[model samples]
Target: MVPSDGTAGRPLRESIRDKLRERIIEGTYGPGDRIVERDVAADFGVSRLPVREALRMLDTEGFVEMLATRGVIVKKLSRRDVLELFDVREALEGLAFRRAAERLTKRDATHLGALRSKARKALEAADGPALHGFNEEFHDTVNRLARNDLLASILEPLEGRLHWIFRQNDRPDQLWREHEELLAAIVDRDGDRAADLAVAHVRVNRDRVLSHLFGDHPEGTAAAG
Candidate 1:
């Protein structure tokens, strides 16, 4: 998350980009919604130049389309896109977890324990923001412990996409339990168990999300509508 104010006293363009990108990801600016550079500039109380730059960054990140006549519109993820992203996520995260389990230190284990504790507290409190933040931190820390920056880089965007989906159908208690189970495997240095747990965790969530989105759930029952 980029801060709004940079060290130089002006609003950082990266901050504006982050805010806008989040909106796009969370569907605040839904598919086919035209994003006017001037309007975003006014909304952020910044200049059009910075807004354009932000839009460019978003385009590069595959979050928006620079249309022929419409300028910029929010990019929509098709069902295929969602499936593909999560498929890649499952495999990559599995590999990361296995690597992490094989190499986890006492310090890494302790840090993960603390994160799990915080995640459980957030679940008990039903604090959505805290749960989301802690869950993200837990996954990111696992990626870091895997000692593969390339894997971390690849997972970053996929994690962002997956977060809102998880935030939808995932009960806080279930999330806490899954985190703890996964952590237990990693801390035990059970590489195969950790990898299996990681893949199962993601796959279960993926199925739940897909069901909520397209199956026997009530209309619009999953995401924050």
Candidate 2:
């Protein structure tokens, strides 16, 4: 939750936006679900104005679509959307992993390890939602360590979207193992290996999600099945 600074209007709108975004991410508001401004306002005990403003912000962020007939609904992901997200992420995160490896420090290592430990516990408990948040955090921490403002700026908007996609992950343990391997390479300052692992990990999750969405074959790429 975005803790309010005991203010109103803009901050309230932003807080509502964050709460709405979190709902969308955690599957409370699934894709194509119509969002009513008045309903949201009633739920939050606020006026419809802030909810309207919050929905407008989400619309610009590509999280929701405003339709004249249907009002505002969560944006549904297509096969192309999934493919494009992973493609862009692989390209950008490759750079992040390498740069983070170059700048890895003892404190960074400790923090990454701590997150991994928590994520592992989440996995053991079969907590899909908790695991999803921690997974995103691991990637975000690596990007922060990279010290690339431009890259992070480009990625910031994509963060919620990517979390939405990755929540479809079926092999959480396998993905966590890959994360651990990448973390090891970064701490060891093996930039080349770390970058390669990061790209491969993205590809692996992409395939898993697509496979789940499309059946045994992902993106219909099987030639001789």
Candidate 3:
């Protein structure tokens, strides 16, 4: 029988890097937090070289910054950085929405509906993690249904940045409402409308993040609780 324990096969450096990357993405290490190689090596029962390899890998992925004098630190996104991330999201996702609408199939519609239902339940139950996962599924489904590999490839990285920023603020019910409306537009085969809605949806999120981070709202009442 193949050993199920992760200790037997791959090099320790790759294993450590994967584990550290997962933790960083899951918010285990918050912005500007210092990662001590010796400490992590002791905690994981590995040598410091593997831990150092993991930290360097994280730096390449934009999750950590290696300071000349301060070792490795988790990256913190500034207000401008958040906006730039959303801009990338809008461009790629807008293309996805347009193409998905242009060629949406019955199966695609069915899958989208199922995703919407799941997202609705997650929202009602106030399940933040489940809701975020569902939201990603919905968008990824649309991109796949679009039959555009290049667009999907571009979206993959931006999706991670979106989650990183969105998780910093509270989930808003309006987000689900907007998703439903966007899905409805796509289902109706209105490519132009769907494309517009897709861009607006991303813009609204960017606005929300900016508001949460910098106290700038777009002429609206306070978000309902």
Instruction: Name the candidate that leads on TM-score.
Output: 2
Deviation in angstroms for 182 in model 1? Answer: 0.5
lDDT of 3 by residue, 110-164 (tens): 8888888888888889887777666666776788878987777776656555667
Displacement of the residue 140 alpha carbon in candidate 2, Å = 1.0
Q: Which is superior by TM-score, 1 or 2?
A: 2
Give each model's whole-structure lDDT. 0.76, 0.84, 0.75
**Residue-by-residue lDDT tens digits, candidate 1, 1-225:** 333464347557767877887786556887789999888877877777778887888888777889898899987655565566667878798999999999999999889888877887788788876776677677778889999888878777666666545555556567667878888999999999999999998877766666655563434333432
lDDT of 1 at 165: 53
Checking candidate 2 for backbone clashes, the offending pairs are: none
Clashing pairs in 1: none
**Candidate 3 versus the native: TM-score?**
0.80
Q: Rank the candidate models, highest TM-score first.
A: 2, 1, 3
Ranking by lDDT: 2, 1, 3
Candidates 2 and 3: which is better by lDDT? 2
Clashes of 1: 0
Q: Model 2 over residues 100-182: C-alpha lDDT tens digits?
A: 99998899989988898899899889886677778778888998999989999999888878877877787666677788899
For lDDT, candidate 1 versus 2, the one ahead is 2
Of candidate 3, the 10-residue stretch with the lowest lDDT total is: 1-10
